[model samples]
Target chain A: MKLHTYFRSSASYRVRIALQLKGLPYEYLPVHLVRGEHKAPAYASHVGDALVPSLETDDGHWLTQSMAIMEYLDETHAAHPLLPADALGRAHVRALAQMVACEIHPLNNLRVLKYLVHELKVSDEAKTGWYAHWARSGLEAFERQLALLDAERKAGGLPPSVFCWGDVPGMAECCLVPQVFNAQRFAVNLDGLPRLMEVVERCNAMPAFQSAHPSACPDAQ
Target chain B: MKLHTYFRSSASYRVRIALQLKGLPYEYLPVHLVRGEHKAPAYASHVGDALVPSLETDDGHWLTQSMAIMEYLDETHAAHPLLPADALGRAHVRALAQMVACEIHPLNNLRVLKYLVHELKVSDEAKTGWYAHWARSGLEAFERQLALLDAERKAGGLPPSVFCWGDVPGMAECCLVPQVFNAQRFAVNLDGLPRLMEVVERCNAMPAFQSAHPSACPDAQ
Candidate 1:
């Protein structure tokens, strides 16, 4: 298998962590986002969107989108499943993942940010402020969700579990670590989010996550 | 079952189609997004996020996130399944869905657009441009993916199918209609996307899609 990835891309980071967690080996082919290699025809043909982290299976099937790739890995490999067996539990895990992947990260992507400055002529201060605004608000909502999950468990609404679903850390943790990383980088307040912070710390301690760190990748500066 | 929804919300619209496709009876409990009813404690408590289109199941479960809700419906009530049976096919369908749901729609959501103007102080023209930018780029990518799928079928790489996955439209078309609605609203070009446009037209011809349209709802103005 081969993964076309950018070292600093959060979505690619997600795929890397999933691959490592599943103990899957793949050749890393760097597609430099900063250098605009993704926009070239050869790369774009493999991924219709010209996005990084396109995974090509040994059978030559190319898959795009981080969450989709993660789900595929979980389904095909099944060693370290990224979703719970139960329907509701799977829904909860997916909701947590989408809260970050769908709601938060898209607005803060490199292309979107660049568009804000170059096309919309947003000032530097305002741009950073914009970043912090979305980050803080989204994280606050995420914290609320985590609190609700814990509260549900306390109230006996959910079964006792160490992770988001049962004992396994599925898509929720996959998404949480990166958003938390970005939040810390942007200096967003992490106060009053003990449960969320605890999960982040636990996830960060894993070798899979450690290896998937953007800085640890060969393409990172 | 009850669905807390605002008729004009794309997320809610997707759920509406899914429910209709499955022939499930659901009470519509309108949560007026413009009136900030989603933020009210009663509604916010039900859903950790102040997002709309939360499904309250007959078993008293509250499901949030449109995609998650759709997946749950697909799992628990599988008469008219929305995902392909095969893992690879499911991944492709989901990738197409997220290409719209995560990539395009989130950036152009009501709150995000409001933030663009009020918080970032972007001009109305620039804000509209921002909306069009994402829609255009996202649709262009979608077209590319569809083209590849079509090309594969033409070359006998994959089976020829009526829909994104097979006979049923699946998540791809669930996401596609709202995006096309947004694209038309933004006046983005649809000139190069014959396959997608054909699919859109076919989907609109179905009662599920027609009934779930924003303008077809009681709250539409």
Candidate 2:
């Protein structure tokens, strides 16, 4: 497998973490998003969205979208399952994942920031503010969901979840770790989200997550 | 099942279509997003993000995030499968769905637009421009993916996909139809996306999509 990735992209970082967790080996193909490499014909014509973290499978299928790609990896390589076995458990984990994927990262990605600065002509201060607002609010939601899940677990006579859902760090961690990384990078307020921050700390301690960090990437500046 | 939804929310509309497709009988509980009902304690205290289109399952579990909720419904009911049976096919379908879900819808949602206007003070004209730009560009990407999938189908000696994957309108259509609904509402230029529009027309002809239309909702103005 070959992953087309950008070092600092949260989506790319997500796929990298998934690959590491599953102990899958893949060549890292870096696309310089800031340099307009993703828009060039070489990359754009082949990939449908011309987006980073597109996984070129061993069988030559090119898959885009981090959530879809990570799910695909889990389905195909079932050694380290990313989702839970039951339906409702899967739903809980996925909702936590989407809180970052859909609600937060989409608003703070490089392109959206570029649009705000260039098209809307917003100042640097406003740009950072926009990024921080979404990250902080989205993390707050994540923490609340964690609390709800914890209460549910207690009610069910199950122990508190060591990770996002259970004792294991699965799909939700793959998303949350990268998002918290972005939050810290932008200096987003992370004071009150203790549950989310604890999950982040647990994930960062894992070898897989540490291996997948942007700083460890070959293209990291 | 009871769905907490707003008529015009694309995410809510997506779940409505999914429920209709599955033949699931769900009570529609409308949450007026524009009126700030979603943020009220009655809704916010129960829901993780207090977002619309939350599915309160028969067992009384509140499922949030349209993608996760739809998948949960598909898994529990299993009567009308939203995803393909095979792994790769599921990935392809999911990536197509995320093209709209994760990429397009997030940027143009009510909250983001409100932030642009109230917080950043962007003019109405610029706000509309921002909406059109993301919608048009995102649709262009969706069109490109459909084309790529079509070619892949032909190469594999299979018939061309009639409705985003096969003859049936599945998960991808559930997401695409609502997004196109929003695109039309915003008057985003839909000139170049023939394949996407064709799917939209086909989906509109179906009873499920018709029943899920925003105008059919009791709360729609």
Any runs in candidate 2 off by more than 4 Å, and if so which? none
lDDT of each: 0.86, 0.92
Instruction: Please provide, for model 2 over A29-140, each residue's C-alpha lDDT reduced to its tens digit, 9 standing for 90 to 100.
Output: 9999999999999888767888888988888788899999999999989888899898988999999999999999989999999999999999999999999999988989
Model 2 lDDT tens row, B1-221? 89999999999999999999999998999999988999999999878788988988887788899999988988888888999898889999999889898899999999999999999999999999999999998989999989988988888888989888877888999999999999898888899789989999999999999999999999999
Model 2 chain B: ten consecutive residues of lowest lDDT: B53-62
Candidate 1 error regions (>4 Å): A157-159
Model 2 TM-score (2 dp) = 0.99
- Candidate 2: chain B TM-score equals 0.98
Q: What is the C-alpha lDDT profile of model 1 across B142-163, one tens digit per residue? A: 9889877667556656667687
Q: Residue B149's C-alpha lDDT in candidate 2?
A: 88
State TM-scores per candidate: 0.97, 0.99
Two-chain DockQ for model 2: 0.85
lDDT of 1 by residue, A101-167 (tens): 9888998889988998999888988888888887777878888887776666667656666765567
Residue A64 CA error for candidate 2 (Å)?
0.6
